[model samples]
Target chain A: MSAQIVAFGLLGGLVLYSAWRVATAPLITHAALFLALTLVGVAGFFFMLQAEFLAVVQILVYVGAVMTVIIFAIMLSTPALIRSGERPTLIQQILSPRYGAIPLLVGVAVTLLLLLAYGTVSWDQVPLTFHPSSQFPGGSTAQGTTGLIGEALLTRYIVPFEVVSLLLLAAMVGAIVLAVEGSRGKEDEARD
Target chain B: MTDVPVEAYLVVAVLLFGLGLFTALRRTNAIMILMGIELMLNAVNLNLVAFSRYLPAGLVDGQVFAVFVITLAAAEAAIGLGIVLMLARKRQSVDVSDFTELKG
Candidate 1:
């Protein structure tokens, strides 16, 4: 097999494994770390797919910004939540494990089946419109140019773009309210 | 050029989705489940980007939509996690089971 194939195959396996770990692990902090690994693996997949810009963005946004905030929230709000242990609860012993087994098996079985089916697809018949003239950001052509993505976002998806802006504003307001509400309650209790 | 089969991407998406689903449904910790949901969202985004590369369309619709999906997912995550934080500060626990006030 070619190096590209080997690299991509391993990358795919790594990503899936990390994702599975994220789902199964009990500790919130470990889950966060595993999430970072999953994101890194996704970045590798982007590289293998020849979508360089997307790959970098995957790491920068998912791993850097989103994850950092999540972990921070966990640390500040509940350090005990991150404690590593399977609690002796019914949900821990019987429910979650039992419930998780089905999806795990199905996910594995369906993936293999899909691989077999994909092996049968004819590549030459898969229509593509690759042009040598276009410079996809980060020298990748298998996907789209950054310019095209920007243009499409601003022109075609102006509504969603504006919606995202509103959503972010709402989130900021909500976070402030939640964090502040707790402190206010504590002050009221102290006054009593 | 080294070709990538569409099936490979599909398989990845399935696994990611399954993991996300399990985490969301089973995990007691709210943040972990949110992470799982993000994983699933990323899985769908992967499918979009893959098809944008290999599929019949020249419109790059897959990439555009995927970008929008990512943006929206991020916004949702920020808001959702913020609410969780607020709840955590008040309750001192992130366990979903602890929030029993919602049960009718």
Candidate 2:
């Protein structure tokens, strides 16, 4: 339990810090890297929560796929688009411009409200464990985390599964179309 | 595995969400705003998984929801990044503030 606590503290701190860096990093490339770190930290939390499938998926999708695309976008774009000509110092980046104060106030207010709600809830009084017999009909334990998730995905949630597949298909096609069109336009400009 | 309190997860979720909110609102880059949205979605997934584990039901509902969130986030990121690229190509920039020609 002590080890779990320590791991959680470390992972949680890393997540929070990197998330702040994702927001405040001056360069888009730096922000994307910090975003990847934040995703890895969240994957740690997923593992701590014993959701093995989620941890793997989080690492694969967020860290592998999504972060790669974001970094690619940062690279493909001109430096002027990725970062302002002025490379602000870290302190200046943290201070940001005057516009930052509004968002900061809003974010802090939302966080405090959530914390207040969390404090008022009596989560400790709630029973944490459920009978294994009630969950899995066979004599399997929670070690089969991935199996359980697969079963749930297919059996009870088939409709949403098909819908998500369709959504992914549409997104893939749309992305390709947009990318090709942009290149074509650039080619036309070059000809001009 | 129930040794950890649900509150701890909730606290982390709140912090992630807050950071995401700040990122989304403050950043002018469209891609950074998209990253912020991803952070917020991950926070929601954490909340769902924590409840799924701690609630007496112990069902995999939370994990299923989390999977969906991840899928949708991936889709959103692909489309959003494409849009950002096109915007950059069109205006020679990806800053959100510069794309406000539709402002009435």
Candidate 3:
């Protein structure tokens, strides 16, 4: 086995294990932390895929920003709810012979169906090497991906880029409004 | 140097998506469900990056699209967490099963 395959096996195992924990960990806080680990593993995959820019963004955005938001949400929640909400062990739930098995079954079914679909296509024609035309932006080097992506964002993808910025602005405003309203409601209840 | 096959990456992405689906369906906590959604998004991003690396003529489009997807995921997380916080405040619980006001 090549070192690349071994590395991939290790990273993939870490990702799958952490993802399973995120699904089954009894404590909400533990699950959130596990989710961060899963994201980090995915970032490792991005690095192995030669998308260095994306790897950095994955760590920065998902592991850093998104995980922080999730942890904060978990912290702000009622302690009683967080403590007592999800208490069943994964094995117990799977073996309970009730609706507990449904999620697992559904997940397995979806994965099998997707694999079946993937098998229908012949991917042998796809090249395993990363070779972009010399005319392509960034010239196909590992370091060029970031520059290429930046150029694309400004040139061919300008419209979508601008729209996403607008969407982010809207989402930010909406979140602040919702959060402020929630706290204001609490204050009103206090006054009453 | 032996390169990893794109199929290997696809398999990992598929497994990740399945696990995300399971988490979203199995968890009653709204934040956990959101986490599951994030996992699914990450899986999709993996697929995009893998294709970008191996596919001829793919150039940088896949990476650009992945960036957009990541941006969208961030926005979705912010909005989803905000809504969940509001629900928790009003209902005193984050359990999805408890919010049944619309069952009529």
Question: Each candidate: fraction of true contacts kept?
Answer: 0.44, 0.71, 0.82
Error of 1 at A168 (Å): 2.4
Give lDDT per model, in order. 0.73, 0.84, 0.87
Model 3, A1-192: lDDT tens digits are 888889999999999999999888888888998999999999999877777789999999999999999988888875765566646666788876533588899999999999999999888764566553453334454555787788889999999999999999999999999999999999999999
Residue B21 CA displacement from its true place in model 3, Å: 0.1
Q: Is candidate 1 or 2 superior in TM-score?
A: 2
What would the per-residue lDDT of candidate 1 be over residues B12-47, giving only the tens digit for each residue? Answer: 777787677766766767887788789888888888
| lDDT score of residue A61 within candidate 3 | 92
Native contacts kept (model 2): 0.71
Q: What C-alpha lDDT does candidate 1 achieve relative to the native structure?
A: 0.73
Give candidate 2's iRMS in Å, 1 decimal.
Answer: 2.3
Q: Write the per-residue lDDT of candidate 1 for residues A1-192, one digit (tens) a residue.
A: 777678878888888888877877666787789888988987887766556557777887889888988888789778766676655553454344545556556655655675676669786776755432233342454444566667767887889878877877887787677667768888987899
DockQ winner between candidates 1 and 2: 2
Candidate 2, which CAPRI tier? medium
**lDDT: which is higher, 1 or 3?**
3
